[model samples]
Target chain A: MKRIILSGYIFLFISFVISAQGFKVKAGGNQTFYFEDKGGRNQATFFSTTPLEDINGTANGIGGSVTFDVANFAKSLKGTITIQVASMNSGIELRNRHLQSPNWLDAAKYPEISFQIKSVTELKQIADNRLGFKILGDFTLHGVTKEVTADADVTYLDESEQTQKRAPGDLLGVRAKFSINLSEYGVDNAVIGNKVSEKIEVGVNLVGSNKK
Target chain B: MNRNQKKILTAVVIIIAISFIVWIIFGGEIFTKTQVLVEKKDELFPDMITKEWRNKFIWGLDLTGMVSFLSVIIGGFFYFRLRDKKHK
Candidate 1:
């Protein structure tokens, strides 16, 4: 009886350690577009908010992976995402139609946007609860891929508090921010003219449930 | 009132209501400020790009546009059905 109890405790401890270290990718994020000239003014702007929907040309879900290396100072992430060109919403039906045409996203030819992270730098911890880091990656859009860097904030929620609220353990909240250029990806079209700004911003918040 | 006349009036009313709603939702003066911002950006930096601001603006507009689109579609369908009944 004594040996059995000891083994059970060891097993429980191993399980807890495994559960504490993991990664998950969140899909309900937004990618926005902005156009401005040299003067720091904003020009035409729009966003693809529902990028995970089938109507938006994606595969009905967002695809990405999260990895946690508790022993190491840094974690890693990489995955491909599909954004339906037709899902681009700009308030006006006419404008949306224009965006889906050959001039913009060209949903038919380039139906998805994919990203692959090449490196990650773990920065100093912020506020004890939040971890700061920078991710260097390559994003592909409209058939053109470019290297970019994004800021990330990762937070770990106390297990006892999370359990009291009945929240999933894996979903310790995560937030990431980054920016991109449309012109660099060759998404320029006639309706937007040359007046469209090349820069765009992207943000992601992921709540992942542990698979184990 | 005759069924046909009743249907026609209903259709007209619905159409007007929908147009009003669209005007209220999409025709607001917010775009004016957006236009101004774009113009300023173009004139000042010309080469610099502010992706963060643009993305946030685009994301909000996208959400609003989607909601409005759904509302319009539902409203338009009712109007069309009422109009078809009147024509018959």
Candidate 2:
């Protein structure tokens, strides 16, 4: 009876060690990291600079999931990042209304702006768990879909006592930046050049966890 | 170009100027904004979250455009009324 109890304890210890191995970029196969941050830490920002006004808009409603394969980080990466159109705030009530109106993004008609990651390129190992790469994705905005390449830096954080304070599982910190032309996206507003820039610079900063 | 008309026009200018000066003194915003985004940093994350706070409206006194328009309309009414009185 004592021998059986000792064997059971050994099995439990091995199970804990196997489960706590954490994420290794070169060791694991595929892990789906979810970007739905309940802490409201995920944010996307847009900046339009013109001679008349410099508009800075921010959106906090960002949610998505990305499946990252360690064996093939380039081809096996797939995910969609979405931003709610109505969640965009430009600090001005009138401008915010105009931005969501039919003349601009038409938040009522197309309520979401999303990016579907198609491929990854220029992958460079910044650290043992950090990578710098360019994510080529289909960017859908204002009911128009276009291919855009975003420069991205991603870091993998293993689940530890310190990291568990922020999330329950392994975390992925992704910072990406990209630019878009309003004309190409069918946004032909007359205020594009005078008040708002034709090309808008966009940025996204978020942390995702591989809990599920 | 009479004395009363000149006085009324001067008053209009003063009203517009005072409105503009007060607006500048308070917020100086070219366009009125309802809310302002204040950034807050996280303990471990490098990115920041923005908190929305209510911005003071100054009871429409902060709007230079609206105040200027109303002043011009009221000032014009008084100026034309005085002009017609002189003609009568």
Candidate 3:
């Protein structure tokens, strides 16, 4: 039993070390922005319709593969990004709370928004330590999934200049922008057709590290 | 199978009937008005209302579901009350 336990510990440690070569991601708070036009959305609950302010929300609860090096993060990586809906904040206290309510996105039932990369295309080296590409994936929101393509620009930082001292390897900075149609994801509404833009613009930035 | 079982089942049906009648008179109107309000509101704040809104109105499936829920609670309440009276 003692020998078996020792062997188990060794196996776990070895696997951890091996997997360290792959990048782990820490999405910074306010780094992921989900923007919506707020002008027309207020008339649903209020009678007087002075256009409300634009709705800008941030969710820090983002995760999934940050793995990759210049040769790997995009080319060799099959990454998934998951965002917890309950963690989203729209700046307005009541609106922020309501965004997760059953009346809106029903975060209690559909608690997550996720994207899974199916393919990466148009990879080109823009300059030294910089690459530009497009990523196609299935973006699932409010229990609906739709294929989307995001334009991505990756900038490679020096291997030794690591901000997250807890992790090993080089840092790859990624900025990806994409557009999603709310109606396409079963999130249609009267205002969405008119006041709010049918398409929601999303932006994400993260520093990925290739741990070795 | 026994007297208690039969009595409880009948009480449950009665409670369900009462709930449906009440829904028709009061909850029914509230549900309808809410539906209209939601639609009107959607005209301005279309993105504010959710997809769940449509099916929860008076003539919708969720209204029927609410009736079922009300039936169970009314049934349980009457059963327990009758049992307590008998004991007393």
Candidate 4:
């Protein structure tokens, strides 16, 4: 028992040396992983000449991103988001396949869709521990990239209760909404008119943690 | 009317009647089901394409097929009707 206790003290000592590096991940380390809840949908039909039959398709796939220090959202920020194009289902298998086809999205040519944030252009305090920000970045899709900005709301969390058991962390939960015109990014397929809305709407919710 | 005109008129009436029947039986379901061209909004196509656009393309194909099919059915009905009358 004495020997085991001695090794535990040594492990704790090792953890302290790495604490300054980033968010605590494991015990004594400043890193944590979050699985997020996101996406909402409204049902609509297509094929009618009337625009009402069109589906909004607002929420499609789920993805994740990494960031450090939840406090940074109160200022400037940077992050990268990744979403698998192949994994998304629009409720039909063949439709999903065709959607990923070369004539369409070409998921094989570009397997992952992503966004890299260059900076946060605006940050405003909405309420206690809540904030709203506009993040500017290059949004890439189907091998095309364009400057896009997303409006996001973040709620910061206190992690002091778990510090004794885990890493000292600043955790933040966020939901962002954005819109883009597909043609602006050169995704203009003349054949698929009216069925797909040219203006695409997207929303993202994720939780990120960093070293306190 | 000449026999040729009569035959053509019969074919037209037959086509319209059959089309109405099919519509009554299957129109609600076939037309109502949202058969959209599923395109990924997340991934941009090189050109402008949309689910509704694809839906219309498919819808057009289906419509063309139905029209052609009705023509053949009604034309055969008329030809057989005339052939049986000639033999009599």
Candidate 5:
């Protein structure tokens, strides 16, 4: 009876240790995650509020890869997140066409909007496996490149049966938000401030896997 | 009303009716949207994906332009009617 109770205690202790393991224990030092999902579940969204109208738009052509050093997250993190201009959709077909036309984003000329991550700062550990930080990056839009900072939250999930259902390897979930001024990006639309606000808020939510 | 006057009136009424119908069909939005953003929950993750645009009926170029186009057409007709009456 004493041996049985001791075995039970050993099992409980092992379970507690396993469950308490953090991102550092699961992800180790350096891990690179590719921000490509098979279901095209990655998303980038923009919102513009003006006196005349409020506009909401989304683009799903998100593709990129981030190499995150779990040990040196603030300095060694780097990646680029991209959105295809043609994938931008506003609710109206005519409006979408107009947006992609030369007067607006001109998808034909500049095909992509990208943010290249330079560094992470102000890192805050939100949970055992989650982090919040400010990311400084170069935001390129409408053929113009500008340095921008975005607030981001990242969560690391170790490979498990639950996570395997979504992808093959360990997963990193990133949610970042920032705002941009259209004029600064050379997007000189006449409807700015009327139909569309000059500054638009952008959000990105993506899940990346460390698998190939 | 005279025949020309009657014709212009009928044209105006038709244009108004068409405009009202289009407005009702398009959710009666005061200003048309250029694009729509769609968000859906991921099945496994605590995140959202921008799904394909739905609510197709709520989209189009600014209906204000359509109303203006119809007004210009009616204006041309009214101008011709006035010219004809003057000649007579």
Candidate 6:
């Protein structure tokens, strides 16, 4: 029995080592949505605290995939994010219904919006313990795909030895900011018949541990 | 099954009816007015209101309205079922 217990401990340790190499993206990350007019003033800001709501509006069972290279932490990030367009919620039931209608997202036809990262610049320390990078990727929305570049900032959260054991790797907080033009993606503003400008601002913050 | 059972069923039916009446009288008006107010607010002072605030109001209405509407429909259905059983 003692020998069996020892082997079990060893097996658990190995599994932990393997898993520790890559950090898992937190679902509760903050994603702020904004829409601006031609004048460049900020118009509307919508927060998607829920990943399910962020992906499409409703909470779908499936989650997005994100992988960061520990060996090349500064160089790149590659992953696939699949969102159910049908789940897009603008708060109002009627507005949600209208958004899903053929005029907007057309959930019945498109159903999903996905993003796949193509490349990223290495992390550079801008301030004390603050790191920043530029991530370039293709964002697919409303059945249209376009290239997008986002600026990301990372901050280290801990320097204590006790905290190190409780949570492995340096505790990292990430914030990414980017913009998209709805017109570029061919999304027509159905709610207001007038053509709403394409520029939409997106900001996301993720907190997790980075290995290596 | 018996007089007691029939009485209980009748009470449930009455409760459901009262709920519907209350919803129509108070909830319905509030729901309608809020909807109109939201539209007007968006149009007249688009700059004054942030998208976050607007979304919050809309989300609250949608969630509350859906719950009330669903409750009424489901409660009515159950109440009618009990009445039918009592008659049989």
- lDDT winner among the candidates? 2
The order of the candidates by TM-score, greatest first, is: 2, 5, 4, 3, 1, 6
Complex DockQ, candidate 3 = 0.01
- The pairs that clash in candidate 5 are A90-B35, A90-B36, A91-B35, A91-B36
Weakest ten-residue segment in model 2 chain B by summed lDDT: B45-54
DockQ score for model 5:
0.46
Interface RMSD of each: 15.1, 3.2, 16.0, 13.7, 3.7, 14.8
Q: Per lDDT, what order, best first? A: 2, 5, 3, 4, 6, 1
Once fitted onto the true fold, the runs of candidate 6 whose alpha carbons sit more than 4 angstroms away are A1-62, A126-130, A155-173, A207-212, B1-88
TM-score of each: 0.48, 0.75, 0.49, 0.53, 0.74, 0.44
Native-referenced DockQ of model 6: 0.03
Q: For candidate 6, lDDT tens digit of each residue in A1-212?
A: 99999999999987754333222333222221111122211222223322222311222212244454443344445665455666444445676688778887788988876656787665464544455678788888788999988886654444257436524544545456677876787778656654333455665433344332
lDDT of each: 0.49, 0.79, 0.56, 0.54, 0.79, 0.50
Looking at model 5 chain B, which ten-residue stretch has the lowest summed lDDT?
B52-61
**On residues A137-180, what C-alpha lDDT tens digit does candidate 2 reach at each position?**
99999999999999988878777898799888888888899999
Candidates ranked by DockQ = 5, 2, 4, 6, 1, 3
Candidate 4 global CA lDDT score: 0.54
Where model 3 places Cα greater than 4 Å from the true spot, the runs are A1-51, A66-69, A72-75, A161-168, A189-195, B1-88
Proportion of native contacts kept per candidate? 0.00, 0.36, 0.00, 0.00, 0.64, 0.05
Off by over 4 Å in 1: A1-61, A73-86, A127-129, A158-167, B1-88
lDDT of model 6 at position B69: 67
Residue A201 lDDT in candidate 2: 95
Report how far off residue B4 is in candidate 5 (Å). 12
TM-score of chain A of each: 0.60, 0.84, 0.67, 0.64, 0.86, 0.56
Model 3 lDDT tens row, B1-88: 4467568778667766776676665545322223222222122112222211222334423465677687678766666555645434
Per-residue CA lDDT of model 1 for A32-52, tens digit only, reads 111111231122123332232
Return the lDDT, model 1, position A73.
Answer: 30
TM-score of 6: 0.44
TM-score of chain B of 5: 0.57
